[model samples]
Every structure is written in C-alpha cells, then in structure tokens.
Target chain A: MAVNESLRVLRTIHYDEHHYSLFVSAGTIGPKTKPGHFAMIQAGEGFRPYLRRAFSIADVTKVAGVPALEFVVKIVGVGTAALARFAEGTPLPVLGPLGVPFPIDDLLPSDRVALVAGGIGLAPLVLLARTLAARGIAADLFYGGRNENDVLKRADFERFLGPHRCRYATDDGSLGRRGRVTELFTNALAGGVRYRRVYACGPVAMFRALAELLAEAKLEGSFAMESEMACGFGVCLGCVVPMVDGRFATICKEGPCVSPAQIDWARL
Target chain B: MTVDLSTAFGRLRLKNPIGTASGTFGYGLEFAHYLDLAALGAISVKGLSFRPCHGNPPPRICETDAGMLNAIGLQNVGVDAFLAEKLPELARLGATVIANVWGDTEDDYVAVVERIGSDRRVAAIEVNVSCPNVVKGGMIFGNNPEALAALVKRIRAATGHPLVVKLSPNVTDIVACAHAAVDAGADALSLINTLVGLAIDLERREPKIGFTTGGLSGPAIRPVALRMVWEVRKAIPKIPIFGMGGIETVEHVVEFLIAGANAVQIGTANFRDPSLASRLVGELAAWCEDHGVARVSDLVDTLRTRPRPDHEFA
Candidate 1:
C-alpha cells in the first residue's frame, strides 16, 4: 500500500561537489519506510520531465523532533537536476514508500553477510546496514566509487559499521584501493573471508558480473535493481526484469530487491 | 445533492465517466490499497493475448520530454490465466472490468475474446489494435481501415460482451479508423493508443529503448488525442467515445468531454498518482457543482464552434 505525501524540504546536505542529500519532512512516510523501498519523486512543478523519478530511502531520521526522510541524489539528467536545485521548505509531491524491501529477516545474527554497493547504489545499502546493526548483526560493507567524490557517504557507512569493518575501492586510485569494487570482493573471497550471504545494489552490469562470481563461489545473494519506472506499482509494466524461469517480473512489485536465482543473466 | 455521474456506452452503463486506461490499471486489484475499487466507473486491465507473452527485452522504457516511451510488447499471462486468476478478484470487487485483448494475428484476437465470451464479470471487451511494439498484427490491423473493420467484425461475432475498439493515432486519418470500427458493429471507441516514437541515448550512440522504437504516451500526446476524439465524434455522431492520452487532472477530463468524449481514461497519470482516478471522480463532481451543471454527461460534445465569417466570400 502506497500513499502520496506533500512533504517539505527540511534541509540539504552536500556530500561533495556533485552529490547531495535531501532531508524532507516525512508526514506518514516514517512509519511506512523500509530498506530498498523508494519514492516516486516529482522533479519539478510542471510536465516538462513528465514521469516521476524513483529514489531509494537512503536514511530516515528526526529533525527537531519531527520525522524526516533523506534521499541521496546524483545530478545526472533534467529530473535529478531539477530536484537538486530545491531549497529549504520546498514542497515535494512524493508517492511511496514503494516496492518490495530487502529480506533482512532471512539472516541470523551469526550469519556473516556482506553489503556491497557501487557509486550512488550505496543509498539503499546504507539503510540496510543500519538495520542490520540495530539487529545486533555485524555485517561488513564493501563500497566502490570512481573517486573520493563518488563515494559520497563514507562517514555514514563507517559510523554504522565501524571503520575497520568497512572497506573501500576507487577506479581512479583517489580513494582506498585503485580498482573496481568487485576486485575488492574477489580479494576478500580469496583471503578465506567466507561470507554466508551477500546483499548488493548497483548498475546492471555490476549485478551481472556479481551473479557470475556468486555462482562460481556457490554463494547466494540478493540484488536491488533499478529501471526506468512510470508507476511504482504493477500496472505500468514499464519496469520489467526478465526472470530465470522464463517469465518477466515487474521490478516495482516483485522486486527492487530480487535473489540472484530470480534473474536470467543470459537475457540481461 | 448527489450529481448524476452515471454514463452509458451502448448497453454498458458506468457509475461515472471515469475509468482506468488499459495497461495502466492492472486487474483493478493492484491499487486496492490506495482507493475503493467498486467506486470507480470501470477498470481496464492490461492487454491479454491467446498465449502468454514475455514482452520485449530490457531497456524497454525511457523518459522523453513531457512523456515516456515503452515497448512492453503486451506482456501478460494468456487469456486462460487471466480469467482464472484475475476475473475472480474483479468479480468479488464488483468492478466493471473491461478486458483489453490483443494478438499477433486475427485468429489470436478472436480466440482471446471467445475464451472470455461468457464471463459475467467482464463488462466489455476492448480490442487493442494499436500496439506499436510487436512485429506482428498490432499496428498493421489498426493502420488500415479494411483490416481494422474485418478484425473487429470477427471479434464482434465471437463475443456477446460489448466491444470497444481502441484506435491508434499513428495513422494519417484516425476518423476513418473510428468509422470502420463502428461500421463493423463496434459498441464504442477509445483513443488514442500511444503514437509510435523513438528516443536515443546520445552518450551510448544508440537507441534508448531495447526494441529501438516504442509507443509515446503521457501529456505530450494529449492534444493529438483530443483532436482525434473530436474528429471521430464529428464523423460518427452516435457512437460512444472513451478519450485518453496524457490526462492527468480533472481539467483534462473536462477538456476531453467537451471535445466529445462520453468518458475518459487516465493512463500514465496512474503511475504518478495511484489514487488519481478515484480522486478525479470526486473532483469532477465538485467541478460539475461549481459550474452549475447537474450531470457530468451533459458536458460532452458541448464545444461551441464559431460560424465562418461572410467577409471571406466578399
């Protein structure tokens, strides 16, 4: 069940030159918020960029005793660029908290799980990391970015899972290790870091690569996928992902988070 | 005082002049959490075919200026699965279900309607002849007047349910298509299904959508839809018209009705606001009251066109 909320922008926090965090006043969105669920945000007031853009629920916190929702947005196109320019107290019409959330209940405290994210993909994984921490589960975080600016929320991840438990990699060698995030993941696997389950959110290519890696390692994991969505419900059928079972699943309803076995990598 | 929002399309009567457009409203059960299902005038489900369709590959959708393009390829669980899994839920909800049927061939269309022919829950059968994604019998049947008429007549004989022919705007003369459907025994008409369009990813140096082309929908196509509906109404005076294209607000609904549509369907707007159709119902009633109109149906085809001036002849 989703509800439309006219929330006001409480504040904006710039993580870097291009990345920012929008903290909005969450009316009823607080109690309904879940990890991997997103809001269909109207970029601006008119129909120029007609369709609403989907953003993951990055963080939920209280501002001056009032519940607020935070979204980590990267300015890539007209829709995101419009959202990036909003000032404090700007009214934002949002329809959410939508899509199937990550399966956090399936993991036990003793389970050694790894939370992997690429670039802006860290948005949803951060919330999942916080939830895992609250459950007394100490999961490791492996984040990869193009550079230091791309890995926008390193402090937030370190705060959730201490500095030692968090790892980083960058393609440009401006951050921790000079390589792709998957290389860090492969290194961890090679060092006898036996992860019981892996949870990831990133680009489709990354998911495809991770799917093959997980298959070779005989490990199980889930992925939070992104698609060009119209309605964040089952009706539009606009955000469909092919399944391994020769069927198509709507990313909005059946997933935003799907197990590796559900996706047909060959088709993707 | 309660306003009479009830509307009729041949023998099929709706409680209001508002309904969800096909492919936008899924079986009327998905939005159950947002609004009351039975309160809607009608619920048009996703397009169904003789066999289950996997749809097109990924990158099937992309956003354009003031609209979106999608080549979903009419994905659905065949007619049997629809009747078995979805019809019961619609029946229990007491909704006027308008099953949108499509196919790759004429026989496929007839077969789907025949399978759903006797279902008491199905209020109407909407023939989708305008899909632009598939490589088969979609737009081919819709673009030609003779082919459209022949297909509609075949399906008309196969079902007892009221037939609503959904037309395409991609054609040069949409009015001819509308007339052809009515002449072939169509009970009503709905238009315009998305206009064929293409979008490109300049960075990738390739087409944005996987199918290379898809149907363009949303507010961008609304004006074209309104004109086509107006033209069809002038061409055929008696048939009911269900107008849809980029309709987002109550004002857009009024514009459609004034343009000669008996009813209007909310398409892409459903994605932005799941409760929009139900909300528009209330807003429409309020608007009718504010404008001193007793019934919403009275507003249809009331556009006052000015007569040609005599100075041109002189």
Candidate 2:
C-alpha cells in the first residue's frame, strides 16, 4: 500500500488566533491511535505545499457513528496557516499514525505518569492523561502556555481529568501559576510528588531544559520531539536526529517520542 | 496486478529502477525510516569525495514551478567515514548499494573507488561528472570527453565494480561524453543530472537559488530528460542507460524506458511521497501484464520517436 493516504475533514474549529483543532476522519488508523502517536497532515492535494506538517493526534473517538481522529494544530507555517484559514469541510491530505507511541504498559500501576507540556504540547498530554485514566493509571499533568489564551481547552482538560491530577503554568503569569511550566515541575518535585515515569513534550529548547532538570534530579523521562518531515513515513531524508551512537536516526521512523537516553541532545 | 520494477545494467539486476540519483539519496541510508530496505532494487548514495565538505549553506534549495533547484555542493562525510559508518547501515538495509563517487582530482576519484571496491554490498559505482553546484572539480571532467574518459579509465583500473558515468545536461554534447566514458570501459551510463538553469525572484531582485543558479529537477525537467536519454541511447547503442530527472509516476517510468533507458531512478518525487517508488513498482507490473509485455526490458529503445543517427547500433 502506498503510505500516502488522504482524509476528509469532518470539521475544523478555530479555538483562538493561531490555534485550531480539526476533527479528521481516517480509515484504518482511527481506532488504533494511542496518546503519543502523531498524524502527518497536509492541507492541499497534488502540486501541493508538497510536504505535510506533523501534528500529535490530540484524541480519537467515534464521532457521529464514524471513527474520527482529532489533530490539535498550532498555525505556524504556510501549510498550517492555509489549513487553519480553510473552511470546515475541505478535504485534508493526511498520512500515517506516524512515529512511535508512548509505552503505555511500561508505566507501573501505582506509579504516577507525569505529563509536562508547554503551550500547544498540551494536546498529546491531555489525550495521554485521558488514556491513562481510562486504564485506571493515575497521571499528573502540568499544562503550560504563553498565557490563558494559549492554554487551549482548559475546561476539557479539567473535566476529563476529573480529580485525576492537573496544574497550569503560563509564561506571562496570566493564569494559574505565576511562571514557566518548568517552575511547576520544580514545585511538584519539591513538594514530594512521586512519579515513576515522566513524559515531556514541547519545543526543542524547552524539552532540552526539562531533560536537564529531570537529569539533575536524577529522574528518568521520555520526550516527544518535533522535526520538519517530507513524508512523515521517513522516505525523505529531511528529518534526522543524530543518535547517541553518532549515527543519524529519523525522528519520524525511530520516534517523535523517544527516551532521552537515545538522543544526542546536544546535536539537536 | 504485479509490476516488474526489476531492471538490469549488463548482468547486474536491480529489484526496482526507482532509486535516487547521486548526491540526492544522501548515501541511501537516510530513507530507511520511510521505507522497507529490502523492498527497493538499490540505493545510490550521495556523491562522496576524498576530503570532507561543508556543502553550500542554507538557501541551498529553492522551489521551482514543477520541481526544485539545489546547490548542496556535494556535502559528504568523506570516503572513509562512509565505509565505516554509512555503508554498514546501507548493507544492513538489504539494498544493492551503489556509491556515487566524486573527487577534486583524478587521484582523488581513484582513491574513493578503491575504498568502496572493498565493500561487498556496492553493486555499481556511478562517476558523477556533472555537478554544477560545486566550483572546482565537478563540471570539469563531465563537459570534456577526454577528461571524462581519462577519469573513467583510471577508476576502471582501480576496481571491477559496474561503472556508471553520470553525464551533465549542461554540456553542449552529452552524447560525446557518454561515448567517451563507455569507450574508457564504463559498463553503463546515467544522464542527465539537473539541467543548469536559473530562476529569478523579481520582488527581491535576486536569483531564486542561493548559488545564483542550481540543478533543475522535478516534473519540469522530464521532457528534457527524456530527449537527452533518447540522444544518449543513440550515441551508445546496446550499452545500458540509467535515465532520470523529475520522474514521479509509473507512466513517467514507461516514458524513460521507451526513450531507451534500461533502468530509471526516482528523485525529487521522494520529497513528496516516500512510497511513490513502491507504488510505481505496482503500477509498472499492472501496465505490463495488461499490455502483454512479457519483460520490462522490452520497453527500452521502443519509442522510435526520432530518426536514428547513422552508426547507432552499428
């Protein structure tokens, strides 16, 4: 089968300026997507923007008797801007449940799954939080953004969380905590918050800082990375992360989600 | 419903003729994530030189109408690192690896082939003579048949790998260069690397590519590619030709074969769809079986579009 597949946009909802989440309808992969996996979304068809942008699958559910996928995309480039400005019913060229997902079974039953997110990175953590809750596993989520406006779907996160464990951080101190999300991490650890597994997802610089903070505390964690991909399936040699072994590895093929131990973070 | 993408250059069989060109596939190991290694016929890694290069910096690439312009300057990890790090990975991936070798001097070219000759996985060696993005060594050997034949003769002495000399489309007479390379003992030929072309951005009052101009590739280059393939096939009859440039679909593959290409390579298209090669394989099979074409090889030199030059196949 050709790795290239197209999806019909079930709906597109603009949450705020520069941020919108689309409900996409995919065939084979709709039911199988876990929290950490991403789908490569392209707005145009042939003679396209040519490449699709990678977005973490925010959540998946049966919508209106049809299996549907949700992509929480923050408009950044020409592709996302065009998609964001597009009408709700336009067909979206999408490919893959690309990249490795989080090891859901790896977390111990009693262990806390700490989700550290920055801004739009909250989408995957929110979905992961819900997945963990459904499995009867507890998770602590620290969702951060530039301000309250950037922190999307607060009610959705809180409502689904339902006493699961959640916190908020804004860079401008516009909402919950008066500082960065990393501050919340320091506060959580200082207050004796015990976690068996820590998963961090956000910008490369932010993740690098969090990786360092987690390392200094002698805590192990997994990080989800971002790479500009041609074919999210890895046919284009564009997306490559130099591994610890000095050989380059593709983020789309090896992982968007990888253990910090595997990355040569300095090269990133 | 089956596509026979397998192609032959002399007796060497390639499972699929959809591999990338030299300097385009980046040592062939980079696409492992997007594909199953053993699936394709072969991978032609980027052009490697004796000394390491920084490659042209950012703005090395620009989007053209149906394709793109790239002045990567053949940035490679030198010959030794390729054998030590890149080749093992290519070997593990299970493709018939073809290393595209380049050099600043004649001795440099021979050294690259010598080191690669030891690799059991290297199925063929492509001598890149047409790289326009670089200044000193690339365009020199390719435009002049004497220089190209001399280089081919030296490398032919260095190793016994299937030697394929890649021609530059920018040259006035590509057929002459093809004949020279073959006369120097080259087993096969590939043409033409990106045509030397330029696009200008009116708004910025600047050339579209950073290097002022770069190799043109993509759908836009197809007609020219096909013509050159036909011309070269006319130049050297019975010798295998690896035709490429802007090929995306199976129909495009058919066009190249009809133009006298024994095999073909997929470039630029990989940037759009990673699975395009595999899909083309499927499409080629169906087209053949449906047409009662017994062997895919029969498509080569079948176009008969132009009057054959005197001495073609003589």
Candidate 3:
C-alpha cells in the first residue's frame, strides 16, 4: 500500500554545490520503505514544476527515536534544483514505498555480493548496503562519479562495509581510480575476485556495459532501471523498459530493480 | 438537501459525473488499494489494441511546465488477455468499466469492439480515434471528419454497447469532427486527447522522449479542452460530451461542466493522487451545495457569456 502524506523536511545535508541529502520526518514512509523502492517527491509548492520527481530512498535512519526517510538529490534539472532550495520544515507531499524492491532474501551467509553504483545511482545502493550490513552480510561497493565531488558518501559506505571494501573511480581522475568504475570491475573480475551475486544502478550507458560484462562473466545480477515516470505506480505505463520476452514492463512498478537477464540489453 | 451526483452520457447512467481518463488510469485494479473503485463514476481503462503492444522504448514520458508528454504507443495486454484476466476482476468489483479501444486499422478497431461489446461487465466502449502516439489509424482518423465519420459508423454497426468517440485536439476544427462522430451514430463524444508535443534533452542533443514527439497532457491543456468542449456542446446540444484534459481540482471539474461537459474525466492528476477522482465525487457534491445548486447536472452549459450588440458589430 502507498500513502500520500505531507512529510516535514527535517534537514538538508549538502554534499557539494550540486548534490545534497534531504532528511524528512516521515514516520509513515520509513517503515514501508525498502531498498530499491522510490518516492515521487513533489519538487515545489505548486504545479509549476508540475510532476513529482522520482527519488530513491537513500537511507532510512532514526532521529530522536523516530524513523525518518532520506533522499540523495542531485541538481540536474529544475525539479531537483527546486527541491534542493526548499527550507527545513517545508511540508513535502510524497507518494511512495513504490516499485519493486531489490531481492536480497536468497543471499547466504558466506556468499559474496557486489554493489555497484554510478553518480546519483548510489542513492538506492546505499540503502541496500545498509540492509546487507544489518543482516551481517557485508557487500563491497564499487562507486563511480564524474569527479571527486560527484562521488558521494564515501565515509558512510566505509563505515558500513569497513575499510578497503568501498572503492571509487572518477572520470576526471579527481578520485581514487582514474577511470570508469567498469574498468575497476573488469580488473577485479580478471584478478579472480568472484562475487556470487551483483547489483547495479547507474546511467543507461554504464548499465549496458555492465550487462555485457555480467553476461561475459556468466554472473547473476539485477539492475535498478530508471525511466521518465508519470505515475510511479503500475497505472501510467509511461515508465517502461523492454524485457527479453518482448514485453514492456513498467519500471516504476515491476522494477527500479530487475534482473539483467529479463532486460533486452542490446535494444537498450 | 441531497445533491444528486448521478449523471448520464447517452444511454449509460453513471453514479457520478467523475471518472478517470483512459491511458492515465490502468485497468481499474491497480488503484484498488488507494481508492474504493465502486465510488468512481467509471473506470476508463488504458487504451487497448487488437494485439498486445510493446509500446515505445525508454523515456516514454517527460514533464513539461504544468503538464507531461507521453508516447506509450498504446501498450496493452490485448483484448483476449483483458477478457481472461482483467474483466473478471472488474466484474467482481461491481464497477462500471469503460474499455478505451484503439487499433492500427479499421478492421482492428471493429474486432476489438466486437470482442468487448458483448461483455456485460463493460458498460461502454470508448473508441480511441485520437491517440497521437500510434503510427496508423489513430490521429489520422481523428484529423479528418470523413475518416472519423466512416470509422465511427462501422464501429457503431459492430457494437451494441454505448459508443463514446474520443476526439483529438490536434484538428483545426474539432466541431466538424464532433459533428461527424454524432452523424455517424456515436452515442456520445469524449475530447480532447493530448496535443502533439516534443521535449528535447539538451545534454543528449536529442528528444527527451524515445519517440521524438509525444502527446502532451495535464493542466497545460485544460483551457484548450474547455474551449473545445464548449464549442462541441454548442454545435451538438443534444449529444453528451465527456470532457477531460488536465482536471486536477473540483473547481476544474465545475469549470468543465459549466463549459457544457455532462461528465468530466481526471487524467494526469491521478499520477499525483490515485484516489483523486473518488475524492472529487464528495467535493463536487459539496461544491453543488455551496453554490445553491440542487443537482450537479444543473451546472452544465451554465457559462454566462455577454451577447454582442447587433448594431455595433455588423
């Protein structure tokens, strides 16, 4: 079930000029939110920036013993910029706990899992990492960004996975590695660092490359796909991704998280 | 005083005048958790094709100033699957279901109407002659009065169910198309479908939507829709007009009614609030009471416009 409620903005944590994390005192949303599930966040006060933008729940934390929802917002467009400018305590009407969540139930105690993210894609993966940590299942994170400022929440990932588990790559070489994260992933795989399962969310180009790499390595993984969504529920049929079976699935409902095998990577 | 919200679109009497627009509202059941389906005037399911469609590729939708654009090429589970799966559930819900039918050809349209028209669960068949997304038969028929008339006439002969011809706003004179539909034996008329629009992704240096152009819908298109509805109502006073385009609030609903729409459909607003139509039913009743109106139908074609003085103008 989804609820449209006026969630109060608790605070905004600015990671950099263009990136920030919004924490809201949403008691109703926190319990229902799961990793890979997203909220349709109303950008501003009225219908000017008309549609509610979809944002992955970056993290769910408790403040003053009350559960709160956090979203990592990047100012890429007018909607995000509007949301970024909102003052604390502003009433934000959110509709969510929507879309299919990442399946983590089948993970074994000893199985190794890899969590990969690109830029703002880290929003959903961070929550997944937190859940995995709580389950005593440690997953290494391979994070990439445009530059040093773009690669967000390094210490948070390290704190959750311990030192050396959180790796990074920046396109401009302003971060740890001087190449794409896919290169790092390739090297890791070549060096025989085997992961039982892999989870990724990123740019379409990056996902395409990863899909190929996963196929070549004969590895099992799921990808959290993003599309322009009108309704974050199944109704709209606006946010669709072509599946391998030639049927278009609504990413907002059927996914945000989908198996790589289910997607027609070549067509994408 | 009890405010009667019940309304009629041709022979079909709805419990209220509020319904969800086709393509915006999925096959009724998707919103079951958020709303009481039985409360809606009707549930106009997503546009259906003769066969299941894969629709367009990624980035099928993009937000505009007060609206959004979509090129979801009428993706559906085909007529057979809808009958096998969706209709049974809709029947159980005891909700009035309006199947919005579309096709690639005239035969395709007739086949779809024939398949669902006999089902008692489906209260009416809304022929989609105005979808701007599809390549053939959609807006092509909608743009031409002769084509629209001929298509409606054929479908009218095929289905015994009340036929609501959905018109495209992209035409030069929507009244002509409205008259064409009425003359061809349409039970009612629904307008306007989304206006053709395009949005560019500057960074990618390409269209934001997978299809270069898509149909624009929302609050942005409301004024245009109201004008069209008013014009069509004036041209064909007796026919029922199901007006819809960017209706978000009860005020908009009243505005559409005053502009001569017997019934109004909520489209994009459903994305923001799934239970909006259900809420609007009570709001409309409250509005009728506040305005000293006994029946909601009394508000239809109530727009009071100043008459032009004959001596000055001529």
Candidate 4:
C-alpha cells in the first residue's frame, strides 16, 4: 500500500554545488520501499512551486538507529533548490513507495548484471548495488557525468561494489573516460563482454542510444524511465512513455522500471 | 451545532460538495491507496470514449505558473472496459461515481452513456464537451451553442440518469453555452473546463507539449472560473452548477459555493495532494460551522455585490 505522511528531514549530504542526498525519517514508507520505487515530495513550503517533485528512494538507511529514506536530488529548478536548502527537522509531505520496482527476484547469485547510470541517474542504482551486495550477487557499475564535479558519490559506490567494479566517464574528459558513458558501454561490449542482463537510468537521449545498443546485443533488462509529471501516481497520465505495442504506459504506474524492449525509443 | 454539508445538484444529493474533477481523478480507484474513496462527495472518472485511446505523444503535460498544461487527448480504457473492470471496483468501494463521457461523434457519446448509465453504480454521467486536446467533437461542440444544444438534446433523449454538461471556457460568451445546455435538458452544468493554452521550450524552439496546445488548469484560472460561474448563475438562476478551477483549499471551495456553484470539483490540485478532496469535506463542514452556517446548501450563491448608480453604466 502507498502512504502519505509528513516525514521530517533527517540529513542532507551535499556531493557538490548542485547535487545532494536527502535523508528523511521514513515513517511507514521506508522498510517496504525498493530501489526503483519513488516518492512524490512536496519539496517547498507553499503553492508557488505548485506540484510535488518525484524522486527515486535512493536508499533505505538509518539515522541514529531510526529508519530513514534517502533521496538523491539535483538542483534543477525552484522546487529542488528549496528541497536542497531545507534545514533538518522540517516536515515534508510525501506520498510514496510508488510504481513497480526493479525485478531482482529471478536473478541467481552467479549471474552478473550490468548497471548503467548517467548524472543524477546514479541514485536508484546505488540502492540496487547495495541490494546485490547483500544477496551475494555481483554486478558492475558504469557511471557517467558532464564533468568530474557532476560525477557523484564515487566512494559510496566503491564501498558498496568495490573499486574495481565501478567505471566512470565524463563528457568533458575531466573524469575517467573522455566521452559519454554509452561509449564506455560500447567499448565493453566490443571487448567480448557477453552482458545478457542490463539495468539503466538516464536522460531520454541516453536511453535512445542505449535502446539501440541493447537491441543490437540481444540483451534484455529494465530501465527506470523519467518524465515531467504532476502526480507520481498513475492518475495524472503525464509521465508516459510510448510502448512498442502502440500504447502509452504511465511511468509512474507501469514503471519507473520497465523492460528496455517495451519502450518505443524512436518515438520517445 | 454541526453544519449539514450535504448538497443537492438537481436530483443527485451528495454527502458534501467536494468532488474530484474528471481526468484528474483517473477512475477513482487509483487514489484508493492514499485516501478514503467513500469520503469524497463524488468521483468524476477520467473522460471515457467508445474505444481505448493512446492519447497524444510524449510531453503530454508541463507545469506553468500556478497550474499545468495537458494535452492527454482524453485517454481512457473505453466504456466496455470501464463497465467490465472499473465501475464494479468503484461500486465495491462505495464511491459515488460520476462517469465523465467523451466521444469523437454525437453517437459515440450516446453509446458510452447507454453502456454506463444503467449500471446503477454510476451516480451520474458528466458529458465532456470541452476537452481541448482532441481533434474532433470535443471543443468543437463546446464552442458553438447550436451544436452544444443539439448534442445535449440527443444525450437527454438517451438516458434518465442525472446529466451534467461540462462547458468549455474557450468561448466568447459562456452564458450562451450555459443556457444552450440547460435549455436542451441538462439537469446540471460543470464549468469551466481548462482554458486552451500554449507553452514553448526555449532551447528546442518547439512547443513544450507534443500537441502544441494544451488545456491550462490550476489556481491560475480560478478567478476566471469564479467570474464565469457567477455569470452563468445570474443567467440561469435555477440550474445547478458544478464550479471548478484550481480549487485546493476549503476557502477556494467556499468561494465557488458563494459564487453560485451548487458543488465544486477539485481538479489539478489533486496532483499535489491526493487526499485533498476528502480533507476538504471535513474542512468545509468546519468552515461552515465556524461561519454559523446551519446548512451548507444555505451558503450557495450568497455573494453580495455593491449596487452601482445608473450613471456608471452610462
């Protein structure tokens, strides 16, 4: 069941000038929330920034032995800026544990999954990495950003998945590889890596390219989709992605996590 | 003394005046997880057609000033699926369901109503003639009084259920459309459907919404909605009006009640707070009690405007 509660801001960890991680007292929504599940947060005080901002519940952790939920946010507009600046203990109205989470039940401990993320897209993958770590499952993380500053929480992923398992790329060559993360993914596939299962979360442009790559490689996996939406629940029908079967699926309902093959990336 | 929040719009009596606007509420069951479905005065499900619609392309909605623009093209599960799946669940939930009907042609509307009107679970049929996204029959009939009257007459002949004609605000004189619908046998009216609007993306040099234009709804249009409700009430004193536009609080609801709406539908605000309508029901009762209102219905159309000298008009 989904929940609507006034959760207190527990902590804010700034990774850089624009990127940060927000930890909040989970109330009843923390324990049940999975990696890809998201919450529609009333970020700021009033009606100025009218709609609730949707954020993936990055991690379910603890603060001083109390359960808390972490949301990784980037300063995009007024709503997010206000969220980043909120002092600890401020009450935030959140409706949550929404949408289908990443499917991990079928995977065996020996199966290695390829996890890809770009920019703030790393939020959900962090939790996925942690979940895999706990399950004795192994995976690789391919992260990309516009610049080194945009590359967030490197040490955290390293700590969770080991330093050798994480690869980084930057658009301006200020980080690991000198190009888009998709290029790094391409290089990995070209070097005889038979990745049959891949999980990804990024902007639409990145997804368009990744869809082609996934289809070409005959690989199957889930992608956490994003769209501008008024409600994180299904009712708004605003956050929709075109499906291959000529239907529109509300990303809030059918996903945040859907099979890459189900999306009609050309139309998207 | 506890204020009686029950209200009557024509023959349909509601537990309160707070209803979810069609489109914003989906099929009503979608919100069951977050709020009590039975607490709402009524649930106006999304606009239904004869066949399931895929709606428009991507970027269907974007936030503007105090509201958002949407060009969803009246997407729905069609009438048959609604009858087979949705209506039964809503009935089980004990929700007063208002099926909002839409179509590409006049017969399409009639067919949908014919399928749903006899369900007994459906409390009313809200005929959607004002959706701004579709290419045909929606705002087309809504903009022309003759067409709107003719369409309403046909639907009136089809069913005995309480019929509400939802009006478009994208017209020269809204009172004319209001009269046309009421005169053609509409038992009640819902105004004003989203105003047609456009927003452009500066970086891409293209429309933000795929449809290029979308219906603007939210607190941004509240004043215009209030004025239209007042004008329509003045034009047809007896017809029931379901007033809506960016209503988020009890005060906004009371403003509509005083402005002549017998009831109010909470629209876009539902996106921000899913439980707002249920909360408003209790809030409205409390507000009425605090204002010494014995019956919530007693506050309807109770606005007092200053009497102006004849020379002002001259």
Q: Quick one: best TM-score, which candidate?
A: 4
Per-model TM-score on C-alpha atoms: 0.97, 0.75, 0.97, 0.98
Q: What is the alpha-carbon lDDT of model 3 when measured against the actual structure?
A: 0.89
Instruction: Looking at model 2, give its docking quality level.
Output: incorrect
Interface RMSD of 1: 1.2
Candidate 2 TM-score over all chains jointly: 0.75
lDDT of 2 by residue, A142-191 (tens): 87888888888777666666644778888888888978888888899999
Alpha-carbon deviation at B30 in model 3, angstroms: 0.8
Judging by TM-score, tell me the better candidate of 3 and 4. Answer: 4
Predicted candidate 2 versus true structure: per-residue lDDT over B13-84, tens digit per residue: 887666666655666665665667677766778888987765653345555666667776777788889888
Model 1 accuracy (lDDT, Cα): 0.89
DockQ of 2: 0.14
In model 4, what are the clashing residue pairs, if there are any? Answer: none
lDDT of prediction 4:
0.91
Using lDDT, rank the candidates from best to worst: 4, 3, 1, 2
Error in Å for residue B130 of model 3: 0.4
Question: Candidate 2 vs candidate 4: which has greater lDDT?
Answer: 4
Highest DockQ: give the candidate number.
Answer: 4
- Considering the two chains of model 4, state its CAPRI-style docking category: high
All candidates' chain B TM-scores are 0.97, 0.93, 0.97, 0.98
The candidate, 1 or 3, that scores higher on lDDT is: 3
Ten residues in a row with the worst lDDT in model 1 chain A? A42-51
Query: Better model by lDDT, 3 or 4?
Result: 4
Give the poorly placed runs of model 4, Cα more than 4 Å off: B309-314
Instruction: Quantify how close model 1 is to the true structure by its C-alpha RMSD in Å.
Output: 1.8
